[model samples]
Target: MKIQKFGAGVFTIENFLSKKECDAYIHDSESRGYEVATINAISGPEINKEIRNNDRVIFDDTELANALFQRAKGFLPASLHGW
Candidate 1:
């Protein structure tokens, strides 16, 4: 059986970003009146877990991935993560 990662979908983004840029973006997001939480790297889709939706987002999947999920339905907010 293929050992697939289970929990919530994950995201990969630029990590080594300048503090100014990071802080500015995060601050701007908050100032714009948006809830945000910055965590260490893209771990897993985190927000609500009781939904029982464990999905993986392979952004670069050559097979086109489960197709570009616009809604990422049943998991959690896609852009809720920060730097």
Candidate 2:
């Protein structure tokens, strides 16, 4: 994959992930567990309808997280990280 700079503070990597990788991520996330990602107006965790309908998958597996990070590190700018 090639890293392309879009503009200031904007970058993209087209087709960075293969279909198999995406499927694996989804499968692993579903198999592990998923919780409602909605948050309340006060910034607290809440499950309010109409606000959001996405399930957040917490990665308790460091190996998986690290592997993904490492793969993207080469394509991502260091300045855009940890900010």
Candidate 3:
């Protein structure tokens, strides 16, 4: 017989990245030949400082960053945030 828990390991595990690489990719996309504007890095109400000055949102996780971008689509039409 065998006993197990669903999502057992995943629930307790977390993934993170080193700071160096995290910021590196962000700085790289500043001038990628597109109409770039305000960019910010934030968590779900976990944003610490204002990042309006930034033009590339770099996060420790790629998927998480993408999710944020997708959710921001509602406000993207304005080309600015902080309403």
TM per model?
0.27, 0.63, 0.22
**Which one wins by lDDT: 2 or 3?**
2
- Give lDDT tens digits, candidate 1, residues 1-83: 11233446554333334678679756755565633333233685355435433433222455433432432333445455462
Name the candidate, 1 or 3, with the larger lDDT value. 1
Judged by whole-model lDDT over C-alpha atoms, candidate 2 comes out at: 0.79
- By lDDT, the best candidate is 2
Candidate 1: regions farther than 4 A off: 1-15, 35-49, 52-83
Local accuracy of candidate 3 as per-residue lDDT tens digits, 24-62: 655655544333244334533333335433233333678
Candidate 1, clashing residue pairs? none
- Can you list the residue pairs that collide in candidate 3? none
Q: Candidate 2 or 3, higher TM-score?
A: 2
- Each prediction's RMSD over C-alphas, in Å, is 15.7, 3.2, 14.6
Tens-digit per-residue lDDT, 13-40, candidate 2:
8887899988988898789898878776
Candidate 3 Cα errors over 4 Å, as ranges: 1-59, 78-83
lDDT of 1 at 27: 75
